[model samples]
Target: MSIEQSWNRITRTLAEHAPATAKELLPPAAEADVRAVEDVLGQRLPVELFEWWTSCGGGLHPVLPHGYIPYRPIGSASAWREWTRRHGDGPQKGSAAGLPGAGWHSRFVPIATDGGGYDLAVDLRPGPLHGCLFAFSHQWGVAYPPEWSSLTAMLGGVADALETGGPVGRYHAETTRGGMLVWKL
Candidate 1:
């Protein structure tokens, strides 16, 4: 399914079974806002990421419950701030998952946050894996192999898990008595 279709499914499920979380979903981002961020970063967003932002800017809280790790979507502004915060911080040195770059690179645009330090980002770096999704742990650095292939894949996995009670990576989707979506390992 298309990213928009997959996201619609997720939102529909959330609205029906997790209204509290659904209510926190942000509206579509303005084109100008997105372009401004791109201008500052000097990088054009991947088409898929731009498409997603046009459909939903981000979320106001950690309402999404099906990422490889806990995360909430972040808007363009938040993404820029995150990129700036980690810019030119030197290469991440440690045993990594054999991924590109020394660790974090300027092209790794964060799209979601765990609210602690970990972020879910799209690798905009020039490579075969460009536009793929990966976990960015401040302590652990960039993860190799990526959590999902793309934003569309991530949303499709989430929508499938929500609809079928299946798994998105290792996460099992659940809804609380308080109408919030939660993921259980």
Candidate 2:
């Protein structure tokens, strides 16, 4: 199936499971890890989402809903390596599995970069969930997420937020109600 089709299937299915969860939930320390990330970036992360990430039971990488992608630096460039090193990991193989740690590297993207640039709806992965897009938002120290279905729409939201400097890190996640959606950053 096409990436978009695959993304549609997973997201459609995950929508019914909003407030996405994982196998290994986050410990308080892991929450701190996420906080540290925000601190390092001089920005507050999506708290509720981070809370959800920490709630992972330990397997199946905790992920947001469709049309939302994580923003991270991934590359062999000096600046990228320096960025990763600053994050202080020992260097590890990468995986789309659980949230990565030391040694593991891959920027979380709710949208696909496609070697092109933040196409919020484009799924960069070549695998089954390849077309899945994700994003998050942060504003006034609080993050808002939204429900998205297409890359264009997701990018539009992100662009507006960035332009206004109002909020960021908006992402899609499983909700307790029934499914996931793009919400506060």
Candidate 3:
């Protein structure tokens, strides 16, 4: 399925079974906002990411609680701001070189944050893994293999997990007693 379709299914599932979490999703971002971040970063967002942001701005709170880390998708502006504020010049401590993992690399776009030092980023670095998604941890750095090849795959996995009660990577979809969606390991 297309990214948009997968996203729709995910949102629909959330709306029906996890209304509280569904309400936390942000509105679509304006075109100008996306452009502004691109201009600032001097990097173009991949088509899938662009499509995603144009349809869903991001999140106001953590929606995907993968394991213990509660990740919330971030808008372009927030991504750029975090890049500037944290990345600075080069890779940080515990960063793996040339790998799209935990580090302060300009090519890595911070698409989601755990509100801690860790992040979920899009790898812009040239290579086979370009455009793939990986989880960046402050302590562990980048996981060897990418979690998702693209935003499309990630959304599709999420939708499938919700529909089948399956696992997305290591995370399993679950609902709280209050009918809120949560992904646990």
Q: Which candidate leads the pack in TM-score? A: 1
Give the candidate number with the greatest lDDT: 1
Question: Taking the tens digit of each residue's C-alpha lDDT, what string does model 3 give over 23-136?
Answer: 888777777777776876787877877777776777765565353222223344565565556544555433443364333566667677666656676767776667787766
lDDT tens string, model 1, 1-185? 88779888988988998898888887877777667667766777767877777777778656554332322233434654655576445344332332644356666677777766567777776656667877666555544458777788888988998889899887888888988788878
Better of 1 and 2 by lDDT: 1
* Candidate 3 similarity to native, TM-score: 0.82
> What is the lDDT of every predicted structure here?
0.68, 0.32, 0.67
> What residue runs in model 3 are displaced by over 4 Å at the alpha carbon?
65-76, 79-81, 88-102, 138-145
Tell me how candidate 1 scores on lDDT: 0.68
Ranking by lDDT: 1, 3, 2
Between candidates 2 and 3, the lDDT winner:
3
Per-residue alpha-carbon lDDT of candidate 2 for residues 38-132, written as tens digits (9 for 90 to 100): 55444443333244224321222223323323333221122223434443342233334222123313342222222222222222223343323
Q: For model 3, give the RMSD to the true fold.
A: 3.8
Using all chains and alpha carbons, the TM-scores for the candidates as numbered come to: 0.83, 0.25, 0.82
Which pairs of residues clash in candidate 3, taking residues 3 or more apart in a chain or in different chains? 101-142, 102-142
